[model samples]
Target: MELRTRVVLQLAMATGAAASTLQMRWTTDAGACSSNGGQCNSLGPDGPWQAVMVTAGLENADSNSAAEVVDMPMWPAVGSISGVLTTSSGGEYNPFMSVSANKTGVRHDAFGPWLANLFINMTDEGPGYQEILRFKTSTDNSDELNATIVAAETWDIRMPTGAKYEAPAGFLGLGPSTAEDNKSIPPGLLDQLKAAGTITSNSFGLHMGSVALGQKGSLILGGYEQNRALGDVGVFELVNEVTRAFIVDLTLSVETGSSPFNQTGSMWKGVEGSEYGPDVTKNIGGVSGSAAILPSAVTPYIYLPPGNCEAVAEQLPVTFRQDLGLYTWNTEDPAYARIVNSPAYMGFVLADRTAQNITIKIPFKLLNLTLESPLVAEPTPYFPCKSVDSAYGVWQLGRAFLQGAFLGFNFEKSVMYMAQAPGPDMDQGVTRTLEVDDEVILSNAADTFEKTWRSQWTVLGGDETGSGEGGAETPNGSAPPAVGNDGQNAPGNKIGEAESANGDGETEENLGQVQEQGSLSVGAIAGVVVGVVAVLGLVASGLLFWRRRRRQAAKEDVPEKEWEAESASGVHFPGLGIKYEMYAPRVTHEAPGVELRHEMDGTGIGRRSMRISQDMYANRI
Candidate 1:
């Protein structure tokens, strides 16, 4: 049957008002990590991902809890979770870098301290102490499951002895396996969780909160949070590509007042021989759809082609701060007051195959971001908006895109569900509708619909005895779980709360309810305390990273008079080591001109620190 038709039928067959959904409340480090005399001071506007504390060691080696789990602020992306290991001999191994099967161990050194930790203690078989890399994966305060790791190495750094290690176990790899530009095979973390019955379905949800608003993001493993979603959910097909990234096509535009700043051309182009990129290669306007990857982990920004970047800047009444490589609005200008008062009135737009085009309102308060690092003596508040040249072949829709929308990933269906997030300026009347194919409907009618629905759950290992009141009745009671505004448990023992618990063998009857730390086990309390302390360090380290970037920005800051003189020079970010050259190409039928290139490369369903050592990468982040 067609996918939409099946979905409609499932909605009908599933007779539950109470959703059997798993929900995790998103929190921020701003409470504890603020350096402005304990006041609110966040580096980015939004960067909420699932994190947890974990221990790592070899599979067979004796484990040691004292193996220093250093509080190096490490927040892996929700979409991509892996580890960077430094062997005892100063070797670095990154399993996520493995694109081909035969690539057992390659050394990659493009990462900055922003991505690396100071060190990790080992039990002789750990990343820093052992000759090879391996880690035992388990989160802090909990031991629901333990998994082994197959070691993978970087291309630039090799083992001291030049001896090869075993191939990587390869779990939770969002990228395509084999790196031959093909689709991913089964056996991902989602598949494993489903197979183990940790979750009922292969669907997951994400809600990244605005950092400025003191909101936290959430990651739901089995189902989505209905309350968190402000508007109607829009489902879109994933680009049929071999890579596992969430690739999609979107048209770009902006609105300052009436007469919108409608751009024409592609925002991002796909690689040749790949099912990504713009429809027409060159002289692209923002109006045309362009293929781009929505990156969940990084900071907010729309990485666009040089031509498009120039167009956006020209239209917006903002200044280009060379030192920060950001666009800035004059605080003294009247427009700035309007921007601050009605930030929602000034926003961006993205169009895709779906009828409802996505629009996100960026508040002026969020734009006033400060770049403070250990390298910088003080904080520099440059508007965070930036337009990068997409020459580096990395066409990305970063956090900026997500701020306006809520995205869900269905690994089972290989599709991404998107919907405009609720906002102050959103058009309340805007909506999208889809009608199931008539042929499928007629065919479905031919069969016993009720019997078919009953049998479907039966095949899914449901109890099939009864459907309950206040929700759909099912044999197994696997109805969709309801989400509360507080983001706590559903009505009853709804999710994996019955199964997962602390090492003490206690299950939380109130799955959505989180009590005070005093009520939790010693391990849970310790995890919370450790997280608070480490987050402070993370904020401190982030400031240091910003300082380092400031130094680089100072060295390359160019004036308008010197623009022609320095046009040929590339702007290099010290800490990140990425070199960007600004270039604007005229509209053309060929490929869009290039601007920024990425030199360095960088889930999920939780909030904790996970140890992968050098041997194993955490399967779930």
Candidate 2:
């Protein structure tokens, strides 16, 4: 059956079925790892694959907690998925998110190819740690099921293909894995060099991302990656265009007719975290540290594996129509969002008019997302760093930056949000839509996007004068002076009265003074406090460990009374490395009611102070 025909039918049945019953234990260790496709050999001995392991299964998170086995191949591939989201006026809108994926869905008259989501079990077990990926899917033996792309649902059909042979026992629970196989391994070239030399570092980590299943089946979008040290993030404009074009094409196909979702693109950014300066960095949870952003010109590309695809990379199927939407940050500032001195509107200009001379989304529209995580930034020396107690509660809040912007994606939902941005020409502007074939976003929209970005900082970046000044330019090539409400001419081009204005070129007289102000933010201060606390706690915990190990080895006369009593109560902090023995207590204080300043020698568990001679065993911290 065709993918689309089956999707609609199965979607109806999907609502009535019970959640899958299954579970699997994800493990990591010194064992073999790989699955059927003869891919296991890579994880066997001396390989980077040994560091990560993954186990996924069909199970309900609400009920099952224990690992259970089930058939891995029973799940079938979805044929197609489709949907359309239009504005209240029935006008299609664009998605404002900064990232996108290749998509597939239903549109009989639609163009060349549609995107599809594929899945397969995978585990990367490098030297230090193992990682497991678990996801679920529903069973549907229909074609229209393909129209069900990712979104507006939770439960899904989990199916996996592409596996390495003879995977480790700990890697067993994986059911559905998504990724493409290289098929060929060059030689012992790289592996042999590492094995012959010493491996210097081992920083184990994980990647966090979001994925939505299509209303019917799913969509196949591609992903990308950069230098291994940093993962994948792409150009937002590029993906946005693809999505807009696809929506248009989809609508046309069902009505008039046009090309297919053949060649599409997407944008991405590495996970966000703490590393750079304020407003200069962003952080995504799960991934540690901050991801310094780069312009759209040269973003990375991810080739998806046939199975469960990596967020950085995705797999695209040629048979279905597909369009990849790119979402990204506006790298420009608002002061120059639009052009005020255009031949079109020469009269009085609007001050504080956010949108300047930005182009509208001719074929589509622009979009922006207001909700996002906190930006990453390192504390300046005076910034008073804080990591106080590990959980960093003070540093985290529900909202970070209020980045209200716009991008385009057609929708069926009635009411949707669009960011009102300032254009370069000082005119009101919305999101820019692009032609999928071209990577450039609409001119005015791009400028407006950049302008909004500048409002976040004091001055806009990449200002032409290099002085950080902002103003309108006449078509005849004359620069106009900025005016104040008093009708007096304001400083035309002077920027950053002193210091560089927050990476933007705008000049504020006391910028230097502001920079000199108290450098640390509340989050930084908290980090410092947390760091110190953790360090102290670790020291105390170590001391306790040393004392315990020594006592176990020496058979010192540890009064059973003191061990039991102290273990039960009396100042115990596991991480702080401090444990007080009822009998060997270092604390000397009089009991509340009795003036008994009873104190025990600093002796620990049956031994003298750790590493100290029997003579100098009195002090403890």
Candidate 3:
């Protein structure tokens, strides 16, 4: 059955429709612009181009919560801003701002001095209290790129009073304005900028820089950085406008010298030898029909069908942890170090709308990310792949995949563009501007940088000559320049550094060394009091349960089934059961002038209901 399904998918991809074109221009000779803050003149003659720095830092400069600040690296692409929230009662307070992952969910206070402002009744804007605030991207008073946006004044997660809320900081929502739930939502940052004629269209580009290289990323409004993307651009249409989903047919494969399995033959039954490598290569297979690219997801995972995820898991030394809903890497295994340090990569081939194929290769180093503190007892290496039930009819690629892929959205044209992004060391400061109605062409040339991992790094046990094992064959049988894990040249050969838009000759601080400190604020003191009260209540309840248990007979405890918590915005923990809510009739948030919809009639048979649920889930935002 699996073989038959694979054949059908291959046939469908071969006969797909022609790809779409985007209007844009690419240039590498323009003046360099500061990614931290300033006008990106490199974006060409486009007017009012703003560059927002993507840093792995705390959004609130005054936050002193040591336990939470350590998790900043997990949430990169945090755009920085300072803004004031004003209440209807003439109260005002400044709040820290960061990029929001929840497309339409409300922003809340996690750790900062903004807690007091969150409870104040702001001027109502329909479904919730909202206020308009002007924010500057940098501390520079002279920067004219400041933006005004509407923000939600309530918390998305309503925690019981006296319980320490683990909510995230204030967020800047960039979801599509055309979404059904967002119809009444005030215009987002992008929409407001377009309305004021600050930008030609409601379009943006993003490159979540490498966590391994400790590189800072860029979020460009109005255009993209041409240097970041390499090779040809794969254009995909927004299949579901409500979800802003970009779906594509994709295949996955991995190449490595050290095979995890003892068997020598290929694991995939009908996969062609030409499509993969020798016995060392593993064909991880592809999605049944299509997969969604969810760039805004809060978690960093690549959700795939159960069978496909297991296929990839078989190639690595990993074990699934039910508690965390993630695959924890076995660091004690020698193969773990060999696979991550050696020149191995898992490649993804996506079919564009034009029937053209573009491959994005992610090195093993990037896939070997770490989870620390609250997520786990200690820092643990983890594999980002998660299995989803086939019944849902939808799989997604999240932020982890974006580390090596550049995403560009053209809302006006209802088109999305993607390409392989270069590492920080390979950037050349090239940029492109996509103006309204301009014709943009994609290059058909080969990738400017090396795509094969073997061509860049040396394998540990490989031959010293670099020709036979763990190395790519070269004309002169010589090894390429070796690079350290930090993206710097090793002692043997030195590579030239490309000029960057930031113009900072120094390398960024490593993820482990990056830290921010601030004294406790009013919010922290209030949180301490709430925490003490909650602890006392828990202790008193525990004593009562202990006395009752002593009087009863001892009994074997049953193992609890694994479960995941779903948020109001529909973001679920990985590897959870299907959400039946997608099929149920539901009403929008209670507000003025919004009507309730009863779409599900409970009159269908079993199979018919299942089919309807799958269809509805696929279309859900």
Candidate 4:
């Protein structure tokens, strides 16, 4: 079998290049970026919210990129303090110097050989929840934070052993929650940061720039930028009525320029109870959704209801690529310009249930995206839009919608503030940190917001945009790490969750790892082989069963209304939990039956094999 490699095109924001310097390239190939693409800079001379070139995993203040630049989103987790602490002095916490794991396969590139010496030890305490702070190396001492905080909880952490390039750094999460047993575990990172005195306030500002416009957005820890906001900051109450995600009431409308849909309706508008065209007047809750989930870590895709999704597909001239499970535009079509460059806009409105509520408008530049992947040969333009099929519970407002607004979350106040984001050329902004002495912004914001609500939400218009899809430029194809329970926070953020090019089970994370020496006992080897075969067979049978079930449903002509009614009653959403492997090497046991050995194969890379049982002392409520 021939291994057909796909080109992971470097989209605009994903590369963090200046607009004039922007160009597509393979995900594994190195470009002419400085210091191997790590953001390196000092604290004093930097502009406000300026770009820093510090990559992940460097112990020293000033060090070049240790591994190729890849993007991975990571979060901080707080541990429970109610129980007596038991110290398991198994692995000493050093400065965490060097590249410990590269499970995502960037370790195979030109920089792979250099990664081994950078930092190669990862202490695997093994499954179940534990606190961990995976901080990246910064260029300076003062601005670079080094404080003792609770470790963030994670499931299935992939610490790939090989030097395969991944993000130089992971994202610092501001959310205060975690996913456990299909439910949200609270007191996330925000609580930890506050306890450690990392910030004076519980709020953090985010400005993920539009690479197409050469905008430089920055993450303001513990605060936000002043002048970069285009309007009054719209404060909203964070509701936990749905999933643990950030949810807001929103309506979606798409403008297809001078397309036929625009002939009768200027844009296809789907709101609660207003029928515009042939499409049914789905409620904004049905069209856009009741609780729109805003995830910063994953790529931006507008996951909508099936009715709204169909309305969008009908509005544009797109061919549905079944293999890729996405809609592609015909660039050669004369109507293409109307779809991509029309002065009109596609609007996503963030509004409240009341007649008078805060509204934030998202434009077309933020919606119509240009996507290219190693999975696809050329740059294919598509809307980062999808549907919940027949479901109607949680809608996701991804990176595309965020690009149009500056999002600030204050976990302390349980409120969210959003403002229209200013262009790069608009203003030089000042930074403000939340002080403990200061009053809660949400309280004051709510008092003021009561008088500001208008019956209708505003629609933002523009042509300036970001990349074709919802992701930040990361070295190892990782997305901007945000608070997520699912393992989809790594690279390939917006890419569909389908099989790879050869329809094989292998993916970017599972594809490559540098294997070193290892040996397994006869019993161990037999157990492993049997396990693999059993798993594969089970998976195949389960998939076949699912497909047959789906076929039967289609033949039965089940009314869409049935799912809608069921969804209205609330879907039993077991929190999304995907498994990812973390490969670790170099382990020695001082005692018998407490062995930590590397499971090695022909490739010589290593997988940590543990033969010890952990005593469960504390249980978090």
Which candidate number has the best lDDT?
Answer: 3
> Model 1 over residues 21-127: C-alpha lDDT tens digits?
33322223322211122312233212222221222322322353223221111222333223333332222232222221122233323221112111100111222
Which structure is stronger by lDDT: 3 or 4?
3
| Candidate with better TM-score, 2 vs 3 | 3
TM-score of 4: 0.44
> How close to the true structure is residue 132 of candidate 1, measured as C-alpha lDDT?
20
Question: How close is every model to the real structure, measured as TM-score?
Answer: 0.45, 0.17, 0.49, 0.44
Q: How many residue pairs clash in each candidate?
A: 67, 191, 5, 53
> What C-alpha lDDT does candidate 3 achieve relative to the native structure?
0.40
Q: List, residue by residue over 1-83, the lDDT tens digit for candidate 2.
A: 44553574365345322221111111121111223221222111101111122222223344534333111111111111112
* Weakest 10 consecutive residues of candidate 1 by summed lDDT: 434-443
C-alpha lDDT of all candidate models, in order: 0.33, 0.20, 0.40, 0.35
Top of the candidates by TM-score = 3
Q: Which digits, one per residue and each the tens of the lDDT, describe model 3 over residues 345-429?
A: 5566666656576777666667787765445557788877655432223334655677677777666676677788765466444
- CA lDDT, candidate 2, residue 178: 17
Candidate 4, residues 1-621, lDDT tens digits: the string is: 112211222232343222111111111222212333422221100011112222223343346633322222221111211100012211112222323321211111111110111111211121112223322211111122222221111111112233221122122334554343533233444455465665555656665555444455545546666544554455555543111232224433333212222212322223322112112112222224233344342223455433454455554555555443345665554444543443334444444322223444454444556654333556567655543321112234545556556666655665556666653354534556654443233212222211221211122233211112353211112223322344334335443333222225453233232122235566765665576567677778999998898788879997767755654443432122222212111111111111111211111222221110001101110
Candidate 3, residue 38: the lDDT equals 27
Point out the worst 10-residue segment of candidate 4 by lDDT: 612-621
